[model samples]
Each structure stands twice: as C-alpha cells, then as structure tokens.
Target: MDQKIKSVFDLQQKYKFELRKTDSKTRIAKLKKLKQALESAEEEIYVALDKDLRKSKFETAVTELFFTYAEIDHAIKKLSGWMKPKSVGKTMSNLFAGNKIYYEPKGVCLIIAPWNYPLQLIMSPLISAIAAGNCAILKPSELSNSTASVIHKIISNTFEEREIACFEGDAETSTSLLKLPFDHIFFTGSTAIGKIVMEAAAKNLTSVTLELGGKSPAIIDDSCDLKKAAEKIAWGKLVNAGQTCIAPDYVLIDEKLEKEFVSHFTVAADKMFFNYGKINDEVFGKIISEKQFNRLDGLIKKAVIEGAILEFGGETNPESLTINPVVLTSVSAENSIMQEEIFGPVLPIIKYKNLQNAIDFVNSKDKPLALYIFSDSAKNQEKIINETSSGGTCVNDVLVHISNPNLPFGGVNSSGIGSSHGIFGFKNFSHERAVVFQSKFGMTKMIYPPYNLGLLKWLKKLM
Candidate 1:
C-alpha cells in the first residue's frame, strides 16, 4: 500500500515526461508491446467488462477489445511517419528562409476514462500519447470495477509505473488525481462532469481534450435505403445497451415513411434478439447498473404518462442489468424522454414534416460529436452535411464513422471541445513546437542596427 501511494505521488510529481526518446524504432516497439498485451489478455479483458457492466461477451469484443487493438495496430503502422518533422510554408516576408513544425511530447498527461467505454476511452487516447512520446497516467472509471481492476493489473504487471501508471478509485480519488498539474488532460463522459474536469484543469492551465456526448440526431431521408438504415440504427442503438455516445440519440425520418421505418426497425430488433434460429444470448446488452437503470426507468415512465407509444423490451431485469430495448413512437418534444440523453436501449423515433425542421431541431440543441444522415440522394446528403456544424458527419452510416481511423473523433459545442483519434489524437496530447533556425552571421538582416532612426520606423510599420 505504501509503495502504491508513493508510486502515485511519483507519477503526480513527474506529471510531464519525455516518453522513450521520440525514436521511430522505439515508438514502434512500444505500440507492439501494447498490442501483445491486449491480444494476450483478450479473455481476461472480456470477462472483466462482463463482470462490471454485465456486458455481453460479444459486446465486450466489439465495443472495447477490438477497437483498442485496432488503434494500437494503427499507431504501430504509422508512428514513424507521424513522428517525422512537417515542413511549413514560409510567409511572404521570409521567402528565402525555411520554417518547420516539430511535434514534441507534452510531458505528463492524465487520461480520465468514463464507465461507458472504459477500456476504449482510456486506451484510445493512450495510443496517441505513446506515439507522441509522452509519459501518461490513466484513471479508469471506478464504476466499472472489474474492468478497472483488470486494466490496473495488466498495466502494473506488464509495464513500468513511471512510464505509464493506472490509478483506480472513486470520485474523491479522481478529484485528488486532478489536483496534480499535468501537461495535458483528456476526458470522455457526460457534459456535466466534463465541465468539472475542465474547471479543475483550469487551475493549472493545462490543455484539455473533452469527448462529451450530446443529442446526436440521425436523419433518414426519403431516398434512403430504409431496410439498411433501420438495420444499422437498431444494431448501433442497442449495442452495449445504447451506452454509446455516438449511438443514434434519436432518428429523424419523413412522416410518410414512419410506419415503414417502424416495421423495419422492429424486424431488425427481432433479428438481433433472435439471431439465426438461436436466441442471440448476448443480443441486447444490459444497462450498466441499477442507478443507471433507475434513471432510464424514470424516463420510460414519464414518457408513458406523457402519451408516448412503447414497443418491445422496456422492462428491467435487475439480476442481469437487462433492460429490454424500448422502441418509443409518437414521442413529442415536450415528453420527458426527449429532455435528456437516453443512455439506454430506448429508441425514440421522431417524425418531421420537412427536412428543415429536422435540421432545426438538431441545431436548437447543443452541438453533437457526430451527425449521421442516411440518405441516397446526393443533394439531401449535401444539405445535411453543409447545414450542420458537428465535429464529424457520416453520409449513410451510423456508428461506423467512429471505426474509420482517418477521421478525427470529438464534439463541436456542448458535445465537446477537442478531437482525438489518428493524427488528431496525437496532436491533441502533444504540442506542436514551431521551430525557426537563424544563422549566427545574421545574413538575413535587411536593416541591421546602426542606431538608425529611419530603419526603426520602417521596422515598426512592417511589424
């Protein structure tokens, strides 16, 4: 216990570090090590997530395990190139000179992972931090005890604590951890708590990257492939029991196609629940916990009282944290469910008379991390993409946008401030140092100081 406490202190003291000398070979080797650890401990990881979130083995594999390993693979394959110096274009005034931007590790960083995507949230940022060559301290969500412990065990057992440390605790401990001045802080969770993290970070003026969730609206144009759209939305919303931030918060569709949309959606749900002939043992995953369960339960009751039509799977199973997916129709804007982030297996299908109204409704709320529009029409897709100011946009897909490493992940307004993933992720955790080399002979001096008043006046005007 004493050693652990001391280690934490050491981690906090050295909040900034130059991770393994920014060498291409070294960076590649570290990413490979992370991959090996993840692959070797696959079963262990799945079991832990299952124990904490009552997560299905399949959900565990899809949401957390695979994504993390893919990020690691991406980092290993691209770290060498990303670490290379980028040549910057010279300004008109400095035509003869050269300027380049160099990426440098921003000392020590603190990554606070939320309970929803415990492993993925924590590890995804780590891939970038490692590539950027920064020592990091990761704080896993205390709510997900099993996964947190597994992460703590693996990180502690496999790597040196100084280079990367995993601290496990409740809110108080997390608050204590935040007191340390880190060079950069990356957080993923609700906007309410995201504000708290940002405020705490302000004490040190540390740069922060927030990945908060908002009401991300998915628009289904009239020309869309309804069968494909319904199938994708159902799968995404129910995955991990709709705990995903990018899961279709709510879907917008043409009022004429409402019934058709509902039919396909129910069918997709049935197919997911009763996949093949066998019941998909882990089809609709469990709600994270009873507190979360109660929160969602309240919304369901309120919506029901407010005259929202409910379909299948709204019942709660405490033993398994299993709350059946609830498909709500005729849900109006005034309904209680519409007021909050329905972070459960509840899909509220809203109908709009015009596409502009759908766009207007989304704009009225806080800016979302992602905006997904399923449309076959090029014009409609362009309209949504061009009109909305979201962090990321997917033309015809749902959560699949997040899978693409080429795109940066983050929210715009209330959703979040900074982005992560790919090059965006590396730059988020590291600071790009602008470098300009000058010669000792000063050959570039157009007006050297001979105490000339005329030269001083010209330089002032130029500046």
Candidate 2:
C-alpha cells in the first residue's frame, strides 16, 4: 500500500472506536464548528471559486456555501433521532424477544468529490458521515485546484487529522487511495469515472453512493405558463454555465408553442445577461478549462454542420474560456449535440406533436438524474409523473428539487446508483443492523427435534 494511504488507514483504525462512541452532542458540536469555519472563510471561498471557474459570489453562496450550511444544520437538528435504534414489531414465533434496527456507522469512509460544485459535493457527504459517527478521508477534485486548496485548508483547521483528513492530488492519487479498504465510498462525478470507482470498490466489497450525471430533459406543454417556464429554465441552464448534472440538457415542447417558447426563452436569456454585457463578466462563468471549452466548441460546430438552427448565443471565446448560453432549434435526435451529455451552455429544443411523443422521447434514452415538467394541469403532471422514471422530478420548475432536504437526490441506473441528502444521506453512510435479544425462556425448545404427533399438532395450532 502507498505510505500516505497506509498512514491515514492506520490513524482511522486507531481512532475507529473513539469515533463510533461520539455522542450526538459531540457530533453536533463538530457540525457547529464546521459551520463557523465556513462562515469565517467565506471571502476566501469566494475568491477561490472565482479563480477556479469564474463563479460569482451569488452563485457560490446559493449553490455551494449555503447548501453546505443547510446540510450541516439539518444533520445537527436530526442527529439524535437518527441515532436512536428503531423498534421493530415482534413476530409470534419470537414473542419474548426484543427486536430493533440500529443505524451503525460504516467505520472508515472515503469521499471523492468532483470539480463542479467542488466544496458542496465533498462537504455534504462528509456531514452525513460525521453525523453517522464515522471517520472520513476527503479527496477533492484536482481540476479545481484553487477551490481544492481552500477546502484542504478549511478541513485541516476545523477537524483533527484522525477525525476527517483531506487529501489533495491528481488521478494517480485517487488510484492509490482506492486500493485501500475503505468501509464506504461516496463519489460524485461523470458516469465514465463512476464506473471506475465502482469497479475499484467491488474489489473490497465496499459500499458506494454514486452521484453521476446524464442528459436530463425538460418538457414544456402548451397548457403551461410559458414565461415562467422560460425564466426558470434559463436560470437553471445558465447557472454554472450549464455544467450542472440536473440542468435541463434539452427541451421537448409542443409543436404549436415552439415559436412562442423560443421567443420567451431568448428574452429570458437577454434579461439574465444583458446587464453583464460580456461573457467574461462576473454574472457568467467561464468554462473550467481550455479542453472543456474546445469540447463544447466542437459539439456546437457539429450541430451547425448537421443543419441544426442556432436561434441564440452559440458564441465561444477560447481566450476567455467562456461560451454564451446557446439555444439551438430544429435539433434532431441524431444530431451530434444530442449524442451524449452536453455539460455546457448548449440547450437543444426539440418540437413534439403530442405529449406522448415527449414522454416516449425521454423514455427512449437512459434514465436521467432529473426530469422537469412545465405544466400547470394536474392531469398532465400526474400522467407524466406516473409514466416516467428518474432520480427526481420537479413540476413547473428546474434544479430546485435538489434544494429540498425532504427529497432523496440521486440517479437511477445509468444516471446513478444511490441516493443522498437529509436522512437518506445519513442512512446511506450507515448500516441498518438487525439486533434481537432472545429471552432466557424462549419458544424454540418446544419445536426441537421431537418428531411426534403431539409436536406436529402444536405446530399446526400455532400456524
């Protein structure tokens, strides 16, 4: 094993019992301290995020810092109830026995977070792991170096090395860390990398919670509020420059409303960016890297080559590493833009003759992390909700479902494999161990090996 990994493993092993024995008060205190640390380091976090992705303070607060604080508050408020053993109903066969399900910690855990929303992804899972009474190792994505550095500093200052250690490195470091036998692994990244993490975890039979991305779609019916839908979709897509996992990748709209929807969407984009005046302004974020910019550039070029109409904002400035929020119309399913997950500011609008065609279109692809429906009709919402399957869904809105602590945020199948957020996150990091206490005078002796007519009659009576 690598020396660094071995040392951290040894530290966790030495303190595993101490960590497990932490009372709810101690855990809550730790969460409070973390919240304070984040508060104090707010400016540093903003600077780091801006340096990494040109992310503005408003975006960082809403998507990263504020969300982290919310998770911590939720965990602190509910930790005691979550820690209490739940009583289970006793069966007739075990009338004198006490049955319960205990949420036991999974011991040492590893949290690998992605570059997008770097701080929130890493800290959210860590909050649950700590709340569940487990030591953790945090591995922030190297791509977001500035944010990763700030995170490492914050974690080191706030937590004891044995309690929660943060490691900063590249792909080679992740490869080395994965070889260690962690009790649980919580990863958030692309589907391709999620496969590698799962495979590595399989070698040790390590439990994992994968938060991955896919081509999530938004459906707009003629019965919906077009202006409100347009504004919300614009915000969801433009936030993080449309690098969000649950952002509307494409739009499926009624054919009759296509022209009106396009006009409303264009107006919404103008309202969002008109004041900023340029793509490099603070209101808009730059692509994370030159490579990502080129990839997005290629997709846009291919879409145009294949005869997709560019209705608005397909401009790319490589020097500034920014791509304006793009709206493409007349896009076919066979277009290169729709071939894979477009984790950029490109939105493809596809017109459908009927609502069933929209549902069928979504079903034909791999299940998405999120599905958005912009309709006010109760019947339409219920029909879509019943017929479609996704990790989560939002009605008349986009990207806001994840903000609710009551909802379990995760993907199904190709989108992802496990859930997170709130109590679901706490349970994700815990093992529901079934514990039973058998009374001294149990009923088992009555049915033991005395194969006679009298015993058979007794069994029949019990049945």
Say which candidate scores most in TM-score: 2
Off by over 4 Å in 1: 1-20, 275-281, 440-444, 447-463
Off by over 4 Å in 2: 452-463
Candidate 2 structure quality by residue, lDDT tens digits, 324-405: 9899999999999987999988999999999999999999999999999999899999999999999999999999989887
Worst 10 residues of 1 by lDDT: 12-21
**Candidate 1 backbone collisions, by pair:** 15-108, 16-107, 16-108, 17-107, 313-324
Error of 1 at 247 (Å): 0.4
Q: Name the lDDT of candidate 1.
A: 0.82
- lDDT for each of the candidates? 0.82, 0.90
Cα-based lDDT at residue 218, candidate 1:
85
